[model samples]
Target: MKWYSLMPGILLLGLAGCQNFPALYSSAKPQITTEKIEQLSEYGAKFATEYNRAAQKTCTKYTRLYQQGDWRAGWVLALQVSATNNKHCLDNTAAIQILETLESQKKIDPELLWLTQVHLNWLKELEQQTKSVSQLKRAANRKQSRVNELVKENQDLVEKLEALKAIETSINQ
Candidate 1:
């Protein structure tokens, strides 16, 4: 057959192999069952309730600290509460962000400000320590690998020595 005559057939076959055009062009909306929607709503309600409870408890503790005139303790408790809430409840990071902003604005007392700086420095030290620990762990791993290699080499040398002894004994006999 002539090339031009086969071109139309090749083009049609290529298009057919590309994708399912009917499914792609279908107008039907995706079906979501009512059971799944109900389950999602229930989960959302439970999560909201739990988050509210955690938030209320954190607020109550912070308020008590504030009323007791331990502003530094209250500030630290606020941080702890935020961290705890972030870990267990909704993942809101507003507490730290607000604290940092307030610190930058110089609104906190001098003692609390000093404590914040110390806390930041301590966090930096912790990061450095973690890095050092990781480096030590890697060094230990390398040493262990070297030890394993030395053990394997020693085992090979011992086997060779035994074989040499066996050959020497046979010759002597």
Candidate 2:
């Protein structure tokens, strides 16, 4: 009989401890300095100290979301951070494996499923474009190097021929 009374009080305490849930998704909290992206636009997405701080802050948010069992949100932040910042703070690969696992679970909300697919497709396309551009640059460099070597070889040959003709003229004299 005493245990029943104690249980209600204990349960209330437990529920009260979860009060931070509202804060987790709070709309009132102003965005931190590390969360802003406008500075990145000014820098043309180049490396800067601000990016490192933002990446670290984003990584922390991802971690907090994962700890709260909000895996989808965590993966979103991870992907955004990876795409926008240098890899010194967070890996550029992002939550690829997590999203793949999420894809297999048909229980996910339709909107999230669509969003994940979009990110995956975009990432894959970007990677392919980067690879193609790199290969073209490499080919261009190789062509220029070969052209320079041929020019140098031809110059050497011309000089040798001139010297041989002078020696022949001297012998005739």
Candidate 3:
């Protein structure tokens, strides 16, 4: 009677062992479900909208400062605007591309990738220009320092020549 009662449990254990449990758990890669992709894409769109609004505000601030003759402040604001714009725009676009790729179950579209790359290139160019401008400002400061030193040296030479003339006259007298 006890053996009969344990038979079902033994059968269940045998069946479980026969099942391909490891194959179910092991995959080449984890895949995102369609629902999750859609949810994340929606979030990306909302983030882009918020970022756009923030970029507009920064741009307005930059323009205001520039017009008010505070150019350094304006430049700083402009850089901030550019970086923010780059993040939101690229993230939004990339999210769309990824969603499309996963939806179609295909490889990534190079054209869509290029679209994001172009914006990145532009940001790089902007950064390079800022660096160049900074270098020029530093060079100008160095040149100004040299000019000040030359002016002081000329004054010292003039005073010394006058003192030598006075000394010569006193000795002769």
Candidate 4:
């Protein structure tokens, strides 16, 4: 009887010691670059920084306006930044709609004209087709976001199915 009692105690002690092993966890975090649109945006930013100082300035302006909650100005600057070869505005979705609105109305800002012409002469050298680079990047980002959302929805469905299976197992038992 004593030996039997000791056996239980020994087993419990062994298990208690084994449980002290360090808990294992995932070592990697999800990254934005894994998403196609984010990768494209990064590529665009890198490419643009090589040639355009205006785009860099525009990114700074966009960040400032975004932080200040000046959504309109932020969008404008975001669009300008996206126009560069690097698509620096990929992170900001709100700016795309704002830029689209400004474009459809045929309302060009005299200030932008003056800034591009006199102050930032590099913009003047761009062809007419190149001017729409920001718009294209915005469109691409939107598409990528939609794809990401769909993937999330699918993952949620899988999780729900797993939960349902667990509930069924417990109920059946």
**Top model by TM-score, which number?**
2
Per-residue C-alpha lDDT of model 4 across residues 1-173, encoded as one tens digit per residue: 88997998999998998776665985665443446446545644653554266655656665676567554454345345445344555343444444444445534343343332332233233323465787898999999999999999999999999999999999999
- Runs in model 4 deviating more than 4 A are 1-125
Distance from true location, Cα of 96 in model 3, Å: 20
Candidate 4, pairs of clashing residues: 44-86, 45-86
Instruction: Estimate every model's Cα lDDT from 0 to 1.
Output: 0.59, 0.61, 0.54, 0.56
Looking at model 2, report the run of 10 residues with the lowest lDDT sum.
Answer: 40-49
Model 2 segments more than 4 A misplaced: 1-54, 60-70, 81-95, 105-108, 168-173
Give residue 54's error in model 4 in angstroms.
Answer: 18
Give the alpha carbon lDDT tens digit for every residue of 1-173 in model 1: 59999999999999989876566565775565677557545644553464467856655555465557644433444344324334432112433444565577675554346656665555555556768999999999999999999999999999999999999999999
Q: 27 in model 1: Cα distance from truth in Å? A: 77
Which pairs clash (backbone N, Cα, C closer than 3 Å) in model 1? Answer: none
Score every model by TM-score: 0.44, 0.50, 0.37, 0.28
Per-candidate alpha-carbon RMSD to the true structure: 20.1, 20.2, 17.0, 27.6
Residues 75-173 of candidate 3 have per-residue lDDT tens digits of: 233223345334422233333333343325433233233433554456556657878999999999999999999999999999999999999999999
Compute the lDDT of residue 104 as modeled in candidate 4.
58
Candidate 2's displacement at residue 93, Å, is 4.1
Query: How many steric overlaps are in each model, in order?
Result: 0, 0, 0, 2
